[model samples]
Target: MHGYVHKRLASTAAKLAVAPSAAKAFPPPDAIHNPRTFEPDTYAALQPPPASSLSALAHRLGLGLILSPTEVQQACTHSSFVSFYQKHYPKEPKPASNANLASLGNSLLGLFASEYVGASYPYMPTNIMKAVVSGYVGSKTCAAIASEIGAAPLLRWHRTPPTPLSPAPLLLHDALSSISRSIIALVYQHRSLPVTRQFVHDLFLSREVDTRAMFKFRDPKKALKLLVDKFNRERPISRLLSETGRFSNSPVFVVGIYTGADQLGEGFGTSLKMAEFRAAEDALLRVFLTRTPPEQLSLPSSTFSPTQSELYKPRKRPEPEYIPGEIGMEEMLYASSGKSGYLNPTPSLRD
Candidate 1:
């Protein structure tokens, strides 16, 4: 029995050595293993997005400028996707995540927001300006904007676990927003500041923000007084202008806010007190929400020299005339302290 078993083992070894396909199945021991020898057909989703799709997305976004394949890939790639790639393709170089670019884009968005807000509404309180900026490029707003631009389908990421209340099971709002920021970062990195600025403005800042509605006055009367005092004007006085249906349940009262002989603003409400409060709020809005004319407005970055930049082209034409902005006065009258009141204006812009 032992002799028969030894002979069977020897015969099998000889047969395997003589087989034609055995060399292909078992390569030389010294040969380096190449994972690419076989196609990674199993993980089709791990592949980079096609150029045509990226082009279509760029067209939809109206980026105007072209992005390199690497830039586009990096911008659209999430960290989860990168991690998955690293795990699967251990021997291959790891792809970079959009986290760094998103950070850069976040800062750029903020800089542009502050400069634009400050110039456009010079007297707008600091906190309100921040709120307006957040309204434009905030996480919630970015997700909505990205969705409208059809960017969600282009993103490459591993589906993260969703919160109980989240609408998207595969994606988070922060991740969605990061796509926009990363794209913005790529635009800035590969293109000029002017182009980047235009891209940001056309996409993010172009959305209309209700400057008047953003103002929530905790003490409208007191704020109005502070506002007038900053201008060296007389204290605001709220006077009942007209009234109708005084005996009725829904009595309408019209009140006008005045400083000296000039009427600051007027409002109509169900009661005289309500009318006065509204009138004061109206007066505050008129002063704080004054917008610079679009034609007269100029961003500080617009004057930047293209020659100084590494990526941008040299300027062929003369620069536009620069218009200096007026210094803004402080009137810390908005509601931000508690649940409703806004914080005070920035110290630099205040009296």
Candidate 2:
């Protein structure tokens, strides 16, 4: 519920068209991994995941990523003794068998759903069972079917299981669930739901997804440009990221610039800079327009900076000077404009 609310708020906020700085005032954590150096994952195994959280059901469409253990626990905790002695911690003197039985029941539901779904789809291979089971449960179809079939008998064991997880592994329902889930996973793979190259760039920019290589995008130039514009410094974007593959030699990095307009032109050394040069060589597009011709005015030096507004005040033109032999044409123009004796304003009139 919180995540969904967050997304809705974010979308509405973005449409408000506020400036970037304003949005930064209240930033939300991205879904990807954060790149910042932080503490070790000391309690990683104990952390419940987001997908399993009850709140995610309101937001996630089930087609998205799976939930973490934490999320799962938050969504559902199947403790059998809800109102029993365990509630007071002293009511039941002994441990209850109810919790174990419930867990086994859940496992059985998973297995039975897997089997029913598998039989309907003969083309699916054995490996696809897990995915199918997941789909069935996610769709809530199997739960409804199990309720109708009266699944309680399927969960009973000849002997009571010692602990919660003990009988969970041996149940027929658990096996069916695994098969159904495998099928679902298979379907997702068939639809090409794997991680993407562009996603890596989004991850890098937000610092949520970290890569060993500085320039890790499939097209390294995008990475370099981001570094150039943001970092405003030249550094090895491609070579830095490619260092990750040095030991394994995976095609984890590509070095070179783009040459063509929209397609990959050519690749050179692992340097993103050189690749950019090659791209620039292929097509150089530019636009130039000349302004109206004006007097060639002598201007201040380009590097000059004004300390105050007064420094930029425009200088007035010098008054015209007359030599002793100079002829005055003001009288003739004065007559042309039909002015009385004065051709132009006198010194007093000028003042």
Candidate 3:
């Protein structure tokens, strides 16, 4: 029995020491099933997106230039997917994720949103302006914008393996918003600041924010009176403009807010007190929510134009200059007809 065991051990050692006489015609199959091997064509979600798919995505996003395969994939890849992939393929180099890129994009988005909001609504209160900025780049709004532009479906995210019960992880608001910002960052990198600004305006800033609805007034009448005093204006007074069904249980009262001879705002309510409150609220809204006309709107960032093309080649001629201007408080205060109404403020050029 000892002799037989020694002979068996010797045979195994000799077999291990011997090299292959010749290579096989085909590579040997993997010890474990690899998705890349089994489904090369269907491994896009797990790998970098193809240039063609990325081109389509760029076209959908109104991007004039196509991003490189690496950039688009990085923008779309969530960190969760990278972690899952790393867990599965420990030896392979970890795939690039959008963690850093997303952070950069978030800052870029905030800068653009804040500038656009500030330029458009010059008289907007600081708190209300902040909320408006949030609405432009906030997770919920970003996700919704991504969905609108068909970016949601193009996002490559899969934390869990595909199964009947739980096929993949849901694309949450944070993931979607991160991708949106990442894509914007990529646009800024590949394209120019002007292009990125235009893209931001067309996609995010164009969404109308109801500044009127965002106001919260504990005492609108008192607030209006205070605002009037702050502007060195006369005291605000609410006057009954019209009333219907005065004797009935259900009555409607139209009230107007006035300071001196100028009527600031009007509102309708069921009760006299409610009408007066609404009128004051309307007056406050008019003063605080004034916005520049779309055509007249100008952002400081508009001064920059791309000096080079997407390929980084110098332009044949200089790009057209953009004159920067903003609506100051003086402009928002007085109207063309010298009326106190807020909708259309008279333009006054400042040296």
Candidate 4:
């Protein structure tokens, strides 16, 4: 058996050696072992430009001039662009992508939004708080803001052949939002927290949020019940504040929701049930529509000293002061509408 196997192996080797395509199948040992022969030349086309060019791009975005050229370039460069570049230029080193920067920016935006909303509206329900944060930093809003500022046009994308009737690519919106976040991250990296915070305020927080409209209760009465239970308060009682023209074509009923001596909210409607629902909604709004003065708002990052020689050093920062006042949805709306006689001045980062 051993002699037969040895003969078979010798025959196979002889046959392979005599084959016409054997050279094609296996190259010379030196050729096969050479590392430099197969190596490709390094080339990366979409590398970030010089500091002057990046600063020009930043100026186009209405940003105050700073010296974070590479960061700004990376912020604008999407992963799709990087992938495309790498695919076409296989030998080139992979350039920096915005994924990490976008992630960091997203976290920072969420943190700032949560801190602002939480401090402003301490008693706001969890669901409402989430909605508010979404309004500020959600993709839809970010995309809209990006497009409004012409950042969408400035976004770098991989060039591909256009197909007829192809589904519209979502990369534009995705890239725009990413670029926005990356820009924020870049600012935070190059500058101090206070500078980044100011940038966020000017860009995002300055926009007025419709706190009342944000509330979408499927059943206001049920929600009110749950809220009362959570607070360990007496069940809410709806009382008829007033009524007029009950038998006429036009009827109005004013209802108020109360718990013990505290009147939660009041509403006017055409019927008792409608008035009760409106009152419940009003009560929920009252509970959720708390606001703090912009000057008094505190950020969690303030607890850490940016000047610390070592990491995780606690700093002495003044605690945020909470001033109790209605959010005044109507006033905020009017102010947002650019109308005269608006009671509340628009909140400005400069303030």
Candidate 5:
């Protein structure tokens, strides 16, 4: 009885939250789902980086946006270096320096891109939605891109997390709003606008493609430099982050893996195409852009696993015309049948 009452109260709370009339019905949302899974603290500190820095960023042509100092600092500090920091100086105070701020600003801007994409395109399926967001959140991706522009000084920070009022991290925390502002500004100047959702989606998608394929072409910022140049002579998405001035080929991060549901892996493919497709597909499902079929996929959402999907009962068969309910087939075929609807006037199966 206690359990039953508790369940009723929980159901009532859920119903009240969503308004039962609005949604038909829904199970609880998965707590651990979403692309930005790492603790915000992972990027919280812009502690001073070691001299073994990736500061010599190769510049690519046609990246119109001016590279910010903070952006560069954030890109320089990679996970490997962070580990080194933890191993060596775990208890040192945060760096109170301009260089560190610039580095963190880069990361802040990169994450801002995803949030912008999400707010901009609500129709992109959840998978693509998550992919775009997560790609930007990627530490390697940020470092690679920032390395391009020589922004890999990996800024040091002695300050607290930026509050809501100050755009210390990003001048415009809202991505779509920035785009909207851009559109408005363009319209005001040119007296025309080509602000289509499809165009924006494609633009962002191209950026994402280049970002995921960063390790391929050497320079983080200029990975797609050649490709973008062929089309429009632009530096490409990779170069936008790598502002300092160097480009070199490196191994691709997401390549040739067989991760499913909660599982993750690392492998290599002989060719770039092979590696990228394999990685992207794995990433798509891993990021919950597409849901795994319940039977085979051991999703991370399960706190208790080795459990089956919710069971559903088989549909009851319809009654025949002669019987009040389903009369046994054996009785119907044989002459020694009991009183079914045919032998009785009361409550016919047909009724």
Candidate 6:
């Protein structure tokens, strides 16, 4: 048996020596599966296009110049594409996907949104503030923004092992939102926070919010009562401010809400009841929609610097403290139901 094995090995060596092409064509069993053994030409042919090819997409997104076009490509690539590539080339290293980039982008978006909202509307109530931020960066809104910027067609997806049963990959709302966020993350990584802030502002925050339409009161009358009670004010009295063509086909009535001599808000409507409701709505808007100029608002990112020293600190400038409910106090006097009004001499009706 040993003699036979030696003879077979000698014969194989003689055949390999005689046919050098056989040696090159048939590698060892172990090396056959090795990814490094694959030719660079083969890999290059199978690989996706480089980042520079996506210049049109970058321009469409208003990203004039990009340092890392590869990163941008990865940001546009969905997990499905990576899965398809891995299925075909299990031995090769899996390409990067946008999942992690999307997560990072989400956090950065939240930070910028909070800063913008907080700075612009310092006195906005917590609930309304939350709603405003949600309205700005919510998945639906982000998806819409992405669609408007022509990102849907640029998104990359692959359905591997093309089969009749395989469902076609679609650009979903969440996926679009993730892509949008990943793009923001890419901007932040390659650029500075200020640039990212400006990008976010121009893309998302620049749009105006319909404050009145966003207000969803379960019971405006009850909410107003609670608001008045909390402020220790008199029960709001709806007074007729003006009326034109009272009995005509198209009559207009204006109503003003008063707490003693203070006129909180006024509204015009087709009917007396609608005018009163509009007046209440107007009052709510005044209490909630207090605004500050965008330029005047300060952001937490303003303090960040790549090379600023900790020891060489400047003296802290006194910033005006903003209490959450300070706006209401400035606009309307708060009176205690138990005692006399603190800011005003007039006693509340409950007292």
Best by TM-score: 1
Candidate 4 lDDT by residue in tens digits, 212-330: 88666556776676566556688899999999999998999999999988999898989999999889989887766766667766556555444434448654664444444443221
lDDT of 1 by residue, 1-351 (tens): 344433443344333222212222222221223333422222334555556656667777665466765666677778777767877779988887898998999999888888898899988888788888898888888788777877666566777676678666655677778888988888887777877888889888988877667767677786676567667788778889999999999899999998899999999999999999889888878878889999888889878655443348666766766778887885364442235454454454345
- Model 2's TM-score against the true structure: 0.18
- What tens digits encode model 6's per-residue C-alpha lDDT throughout 117-233? 876775565666777887888777778887787666445555334357756434477667767888888888878777888889889998877755666654445446546766788
TM per model? 0.74, 0.18, 0.71, 0.64, 0.22, 0.66
Clashes of 5: 35
Q: What is the lDDT, from 0 to 100, of the residue 101 in candidate 3? A: 82
lDDT per residue, candidate 5, 62-167, as tens digits?
Answer: 2224333233334333322344445445796432222333344334444445545443443233344555565654434443443343332233222234668864
Residues 201-297, model 2: lDDT tens digits: 1211122211111111233333234323332344322222232344463423333333222232333433456545434322111100111122321
Model 1 weakest lDDT span, ten residues long: 23-32
Tens digits of per-residue lDDT for model 3, 1-351: 344433443343333221122212111132123423442212323444445656667777766356765677678778877766766568988878888988987888898999888887777766678888998788888888877766665565564444688565555676777788898888888778888888888888878776666667766676566566557788877799999999999999999999999999899989998998888878878877777788887777776666655657776667666665555453223221223344321233210
Rank by TM-score (best first): 1, 3, 6, 4, 5, 2
Greater TM-score among 2 and 3 belongs to 3
lDDT of 3 at 330: 37
Weakest ten-residue segment in model 2 by summed lDDT = 283-292
Best by lDDT: 1
| Cα-lDDT of candidate 2 | 0.31
The models' CA-based lDDT, in order, is 0.72, 0.31, 0.68, 0.66, 0.32, 0.65
> What is the Å distance of residue 287 in model 4 from its true position?
1.2
